[model samples]
Target: MVKKIASIFGTNMAEPKGETAADRAYRILRSAILSGRLPTDRKVTEAGLAEMLDLSRTPVRNAVGRLLIEGLLQRRKGSGLWCILPTRDEIRTIFDIRARLESYAAARAAEFATPLQRAELVASAARMALLVDEMLSDPHADVVPRIDAENALFHCKIVEAAHARRLELLLQSTIDVNLVTLTLQAYGTEQRMRSASHHHEIAVAIAGGMVELAGKAMEVHILSAASFVLTDPQADHPAPRQGKMPVRPG
Candidate 1:
């Protein structure tokens, strides 16, 4: 069972300390789905999932229920559970909402971000730029995962800086995790650098308390990403998960 999930996710499963069995199951399955390891057409069963996770059906069942509630999984009348596959229009609509919501967040962040929060946002952008350079320099470097993580961090910092609980919740529900991974995977070298530059500009605007500029930068960043994904056929297909970037030996 462990071997099966490892093969599917391309990494060994780790049970974190103090995590309940159900939480562990949920985290693993959620990662699998959001990381594009589980395709929409893949057949999934409670029994199969339980076997793969090396857990009893109870925890896996509980996890499945949660995923369904979160709209990560949908139950069919007779077809069983399937990963949610948003249509092109659905994705476009999602991005539309994301642009507005995140723009407001960035604007508010410009007005209210603490010194530390601003610093963190700028630092995150710098890190993403470094990651982009590494990927460009090394043809074999697996930098997608790192870039994705850094990108999420940069956005999250902006949200945190905004300090509006309700807005944060709205953004959380609006952003599709699965779509994020696919978009990053589809990005070419040019697009990746463009994205990194946008991040830097947004961060600088927020840090300098340029509220309107921050908002505009965020909106343009999001709309450009949408344009890239909408025009690229590759964005519609989920690629195999990339491993974490390997650390260079000193």
Candidate 2:
């Protein structure tokens, strides 16, 4: 079972140490969900997770509670915990919110970003370009998650450059949930990857203090992503599973 979990997450086991069991369980479960190994909307139980992780129920419960707060897990009365699969309407709503927040962030970033922040943004874009090239060369390589992490890092840097704590926290809170679903659906597709590069372009414009271009680029980038999510067949028609909510076809 340990080997199975490691194989699924592309990791090898390490000796347990001072880290809390809840933290360990959360990492394993979160990675499995984001990688699609656990599958969207699948039912989960404390007992099952505890057994699989070779830990007691207490830590599994703690992890589940935290995930529930994060909107990654749903608890159904009389039924058990299951992964949360956002409905089409919910996806649209999330994108709408993201669009507004990210566009504003780009504009603010343009006005407030320091020279060092701008350089960091450029460096991140260069890193993304490198990752994209590597992914194109080797489709089966584990580049998706790496790109996803880097992408988030880039965006976080932009928010920080904006120098608005409230805005940064709001954006940061939603980013993980948004990326988990987006990466699950779009990571391997050529069109999506190309579209993602537009985000890099936007970041460049922002770093150069081009406010209008930065805002427009951000709008275009996010709207393009939303369109991909809405139209992508894989996202709309996830594989069938027993006793879980069905994904609606696009």
Candidate 3:
């Protein structure tokens, strides 16, 4: 069986200029796993990935280690690495934790953020909004990753502004990149727009030093994500497919 790696990375597997082999491997695999191109039940190994990616084992091994640490990949007792699939309750709990931490972060950002950081948050949110609009217009465009990256930047900027090392560390454990990707993929136009709007609102509130307003906006935004996941029919991820995936990059 063969799969088009291009379908995962939105391009052939050629390493981009300035990207190392390991970085390329990580990007390719992360996109596949997060986008659900690599099914939850599909087991993978570093050696097998190296061969399929047309790379040496060393780079693939490094990429695999990173994914394992990020909680995107887990090793089963009798299996190799497989994509992690959280239960509904687990998903809810993750969002709940995120809500509390992020709301506080937002308030702190409102209080302590530098001028440049505030501008960056606004820009990031605006970028995501534009991308969402593009996605709504051209449903076939592969811009999910672009938007996801922007969303990550937006959140990261907020945390950086918070100036709390412990909060940043806590968020590292709570944020499931794979789940976040899946959630975005599942979002309808309305949900996506609402999310973008929330980002904008949070950014504005923080930038204006409205601490309570920013905190409330952040909490609402996070809870809205939870509500969408719990209610949306397409939110349940982890569909298992039986077969060998592609052996070579497309």
What are the lDDT figures for the candidates, one per model?
A: 0.78, 0.68, 0.77
Predicted structure with the largest TM-score when compared to the true one:
1
Per-residue lDDT over 216-239 for candidate 2, one digit per residue giving the tens place of the 0 to 100 score: 888787777777777766554343
Task: Estimate the lDDT of model 3.
Answer: 0.77
Q: Give each prediction's root-mean-square deviation over alpha carbons.
A: 8.1, 7.4, 6.7
Ranking by TM-score: 1, 2, 3
Q: Pick the candidate with the highest lDDT.
A: 1
Tens digits of per-residue lDDT for model 1 on 1-110? 22222222122234446878899989888777766666566557888778878889999999999889877799898777887755688779878988899899999999
Question: What's each prediction's TM-score?
Answer: 0.82, 0.79, 0.77
Clashing residue pairs in candidate 2 (N, C-alpha, C atoms within 3 angstroms): none
Instruction: List residue ranges in candidate 1 displaced over 4 A.
Output: 1-17, 34-36, 234-250
- Model 2 residue 130 lDDT? 85
Candidate 1 least-lDDT 10 residues: 3-12
Worst lDDT 10-window in candidate 3: 1-10
lDDT by residue for model 3 over 1-250, one digit each (tens)? 0012122212222345688999899988886776666667667777778988889999988998898887778978877778776678778887888789889999999999999989988888889899999998999999766776666667777888898888777766666655666676666778878989999999999999999999999999989988988885545664433343564322
Residue-level lDDT for 65 in candidate 2: 89
